[model samples]
Target: MADKTLTSANSVLLIGVTGLYTVPQQLQGFSEDDMYSMEAVDTAELKMGADGVLSAGWIPQIKTMGVTLQADSDSNTFFEAWYAAQEAAQEILYGFGSVTQTSVGKSYPLLRGVLSSYTPFAEAKKTLQPRKFQIKWQTALGVPI
Candidate 1:
């Protein structure tokens, strides 16, 4: 197959309510949403012999998913997903999916993650107009499906 540069063409984030691990129903992308970022685990250590010397084998770790958005006063998904997780009040299902541009779509699930962090504004600078927010989640066990 010829190489093709992939961009965020067909990216999606679906967050829903579920007590179990079932994939959530997809939702409409927020109006001000800008980007989705996934932080895949860098390495995992496994003891193995390489050239008769002990070496730590490496493997891809679960991805930490993130999405950045210009502040939207009306979208309550953030409050529902992040704050709820903080309080352990209820289970919220979230997933992020990406598709490579191809004749037939090549989709990758960056994270079927569980919401972990939400930082609305780390520093509310006067110069930083148009408030931005970040919401993050860690991959559930055996995630990135």
Candidate 2:
């Protein structure tokens, strides 16, 4: 019988990005129903591979540059704001530098997973707050010799 050791592995690459915006006064004018009726924009979609890897695709938009309130609730509103911020950050980090388009079809290593954190609060209120998400995987981006 052959013995094998089971060890946990952590991916080598973790990327993250972020955006910020002040809540607009116009939003206050809308009634609760109107506010809820306002369609929440779809920022990002995540896909997972059979191997338990994850990848995310998102529509790039300038308006999405900042966080926005989702609903009138301490929890939901906070969650919506945080969710947008995290997605925006991820989009920036993934789109940064000259390296873009990370997919299995491109011969890149299989994506491991897309992990994100959500925080709700006024950006100005939190002077020392961190707003970013990271991807975990094992691979390098560069020309091979």
Candidate 3:
């Protein structure tokens, strides 16, 4: 008998893309940072209505993505990206997330999106801790994870 393909996996997504915010990730390339660690905890969700008599339909009005991008590089690449956008008063460069499951060897594609916030901070009075930036992305398509 043939073996069944396993479905279990790990690592929701890795966000390390850069370039024009309005452009898709296909145009731009994901950054190559050895120390950077990017992870997506929350994926696009259905814009459902409040609990009602009937079950909530799959009519997702808006889809969004939330990511946690962390890096220990002192070069300030993260800050520079946000600073450039802020200085020009334009939308910042977005990322194209690749949701992958190592166990199953499957990959899920996520649309590009802009960062919700542009502030990276470390806990005050902390001893040698890397700063984690919590950013949100606005995507129209739903994520398949």
Candidate with top TM-score is: 1
Q: State each model's CA lDDT, in order.
A: 0.47, 0.31, 0.44
Error of 1 at 71 (Å): 0.7
**What tens-digit string does per-residue lDDT give for candidate 2 at 2-72?**
43222212112212222332221112211222221112355688889999999999864321111223233
Top candidate by lDDT: 1
Question: Which has the better lDDT: candidate 1, or candidate 3?
Answer: 1
Model 3 over residues 67-141: C-alpha lDDT tens digits? 333334443464456557656866556566655555555565555545554445544454534444444444433
List per-candidate RMSD values in Å. Answer: 5.9, 17.5, 7.7
lDDT of 3 at 93: 63
Residue pairs in candidate 3 whose N, alpha carbon or C atoms collide under 3 angstroms: none
**lDDT of candidate 1?**
0.47
Q: Which pairs clash in the backbone of model 2?
A: 12-137, 17-89, 18-89
Candidates by TM-score, descending order: 1, 3, 2
> Candidate 1 lDDT, tens digit per residue, 1-145?
4644454545555554344324444433433445555565667686667667766767756555555543443344543445555467555555443423243345454454555656544345664323333434444333222
